[model samples]
Target: MPTLYHAPFSRSTSILALIEELGVADRIDLREVGVARPDGSGGADARNPHPEGKVPYLTHGADHVRERGAIIAYLTDMFPEAGLGRPVGHPQRGAFLSWLFYYQGVMEPVLVLDRAGLEHPILQATFRDRDAVFARLSEALEAGPYLLGAEYSAVDLLLSSPFQWLPDAMPRQPKLQAWIARCAARPALVAVTERERAGLVA
Candidate 1:
């Protein structure tokens, strides 16, 4: 059985939603591994099996996987029946790979900088400026509901998770708001959020 080491309200939520979206919820065992105990103890323990002690670590048989992006890529490959990923020979495969990597590589760092209230030196910044990043994202999302047009991919799961935090951290962009609304309307995402919320309440 594939096991997912996850906490209720962390990046793990995205993985949970992805699993649910792929209809592989039964195939993956979901385990809650708290970052800290109720009495304030540290460490995730043997069950979680992550050196960094982070939530959403995954183990498939003998293979141990950490990091959000790696986990998504692994699951997509593992369950090809889910069709959340582009096949190896498909024309869109490169675009899919680019977007998949972009979620962690570009979007995450940009968000971290935005939240930290730091400004990048104009000449040295890879993305030109914050406005440029938003403009690119807005144009990508404005075309339709999903990053790859109508088809919802694991890339959407990756992108949507961070974007969920955007409105509070960055200046509200209209296109992003609509994009978020579309993502939030997905039944799997709704289920994940509700499950996490109920867990928190309990």
Candidate 2:
């Protein structure tokens, strides 16, 4: 069985939702890791699995996976019965992976930079400009429903987390707002959010 090392009210919530959405929630063991306080003091838990000291780590047999995007990809591949990912050689596979990686590679960093109030030299930022990244995402989502047209996949789970957290941080993109509502309406996501909320309060 795979063991999921997670922290409440953090990125782990997204992974938990993915597991539920994929119908593999029962197959994995969920382990909660406590986060450090504002003073930066906390005992080692899942952080021991990664140098970054982040939660949402997964260990299955001899394989260990960390990071939100990597975790989703690993789980979707490991449990093919869930059908949460596009199969290899499928035309949508490339586009699926593109959006999956885009969330981590582009969106995440842009949000982090915005929240941290950090500035990058004009020519250095990978996304080029933060506003441009937001604009593109807003427009892409404006088409409505999901990131990939009408279908919702693990990529939506990956993309929804950041959007759900920082709604006002981005421009008022109507399509993106509608997409967020659609994602939030999933029963599995609602259950996971409720459970995670209870865990955080406890």
Candidate 3:
């Protein structure tokens, strides 16, 4: 069985949601392993395979996978029957890859910098602005349902994760809000949410 080194409420939470979306919870062994314990005695889990002690890294026998976006692409393609992945020749292939890469290449940095209220001219030029990121998402989601036009792909699982965006600010855009609700409504998310909660306490 593949084992997922997970930390509740971390960036890896999206992978937890993805496994739920794929309906493969039983197939993956999940171990909560990030963040300091409430007692403050625990820090940077010794079991974490990630050099940075990050959550959501996957270990499958001798193989290990890190990073949220790569994990999504790996697992979805591994189980294409779940329909969360756009496999090789699928017409939507290019867009699927683009959306997944955009999460790290653009959105992640924008979220961090904007939250910290720090900026540099080079970052602005390279990553563009948060507005540009939101505009792209808004335009895509304005079309409704999912980023990939009606199909709820793994891209939805990544992009719609509320953890990355602020709670109060997300509601300002109706389309984005609806998209979030749609993602939140998935049975996979519900199950993952429950699992995450249980794991945190355990």
Candidate 4:
């Protein structure tokens, strides 16, 4: 069975929601873990196979998937019947892959830097600025109520996540807030929140 190295209320919660969306919650194992070292020099849990020992990594059989974006892509592909992914043959497949990569490649770094008030030349060179990232997201969301039109794909759960974690971070845009509302109202998300909260208390 796939084992998820989880931390309550972190990115792993997004995966938990995805598992619920895929209807495979019972097929997987979830292990609670603590925070990784602030610097990426070591793992939070030495037993965690992920090089950095992160709470949101996973081990699926022999495949060790790190990073929430990659995990989302892997899970959606592994359970294609859920229709959360846009496979190669699909018309929107290019857009699908772009969004996943964008979340990690650009959004993640920019958001972190923006939140911490830190900056680096490399990050600036690669992602431009947080405004660019938000602009792109705002443009995509303008086509909402979902990232890829009306399908309500895993992209919704993955991308809408930051807003959930820091509610005030969401811009004052009505369109963005509406999209986030759709994501929060998702039955899968609601279910996972309850389950994870109960698991944490236990």
Candidate 5:
């Protein structure tokens, strides 16, 4: 069984939603752990195995996966029957991998910096700005409802998460807003929301 260290209302919540999507919630060992929030409320848990004590950390036997994109890839590959992953031979495999890495390498940093109101030519050159990132997403979403087109995948779960959490920050573009709504309407996300509201999750 895989052990997932999760913190409710945090980025780990996305992993919980993913697990629900993969239909492997019962198979995973979920252990709620404390995480230091941006508001400085929670503290790190000694039991969390993540080196950084981060939520969304997973350990299965000898292997441990960290980061949202990596964990999504890991779990989706582990359960390919869920059809959330594009296997190696699939035509969309490259695009799938690109979206995953893009969330980590680009989108996350840009969102964080933009939230902090930090902007400079150097930062813009590196990760571009929030508008540029959204433009890329908007261009892709214009083709279909999801990032990969005609199918909702892990990348959709990942890229749409930030906006779901901070709806005010979401772009007002029609396609982008519609995409967010589509992802938000997933039954899995509904369950996660209920669990959080019930305080059943940490």
Candidate 6:
């Protein structure tokens, strides 16, 4: 079984939702761990294998996966029957990988910096700003209801996540808001939220 080192209110929450979406909850070992929070209320868990001691770390057999995007990609590909991933030969594979990497490489950093009120020429040059990120999302969403055309995939869950965490940070664009709402309404997300609230997996 794969072991997921998770924290209740961190990025791991998204991974838990993904597991539920994949219907592989029974196949995974969900290990709750302590992660340092913004309020500085928690410390790292000694059992966590992440070098940075972060949540959402996964280990299966001799393989270990870290980072949100990588873990999503790994699990989706591992269980292709779930149909949450665009496999290698699929036409949308490139787009799928691009969205995953974009969230990790661009969207996340820019949003974090913008939220922190940090400004620097280097950051602007590298990842641009939240405007550019949102513009990219809006452009893709305009093409269809979800990030990858009509189908709701892991990328939709991922890209829409930050906005759910910080609703005030979400743009007022109708399409974007609608997409986020759609993702939020997933039963998988609801299950994860309820479990966390009940302290079942926190």
Q: Best by lDDT, which number?
A: 5
| TM per candidate | 0.86, 0.86, 0.89, 0.88, 0.97, 0.97
List model 3 lDDT by residue over 40-84, tens digit each: 655787988877777778988999898788899889888999999
Candidate 6 Cα errors over 4 Å, as ranges:
none
Candidate 6 — which pairs collide? none
Q: How many angstroms is residue 16 displaced in model 3 relative to the true structure, after the best TM-score fit? A: 1.2
Residue-level lDDT of model 5, residues 1-202, one tens digit each, is 9999998898999999999999998899999989898888988889999999887899999999999999999998898899999887889989999999999999999999998999899999999998999899999987788999889999999999999888778997888888999999999998998989899962
Off by over 4 Å in 4: 37-43, 119-122, 200-202
Q: Candidate 6, residue 196: CA error in Å? A: 0.4
> For each candidate, what is the lDDT?
0.76, 0.75, 0.80, 0.80, 0.91, 0.91
Worst 10 residues of 4 by lDDT: 35-44
Segments of candidate 5 deviating more than 4 angstroms: none
Task: Kindly indicate the candidate among 2 and 4 with the higher TM-score.
Answer: 4
Considering lDDT, which of the candidate structures 2 and 4 is the better prediction for this target?
4
How many clashes in each candidate? 0, 0, 0, 0, 1, 0
Better of 2 and 3 by TM-score: 3
What TM-score does candidate 2 get on C-alpha atoms?
Answer: 0.86
CA error at residue 39 for candidate 5, angstroms: 1.0
lDDT of 2 by residue, 56-130 (tens): 788999988888888888888777677677767767778778887888888787777777787878533565556
User: What residue pairs clash in candidate 3, if any at all?
Assistant: none
User: What does the lDDT read for residue 71 in candidate 5?
Assistant: 93
What's the TM for model 4? 0.88
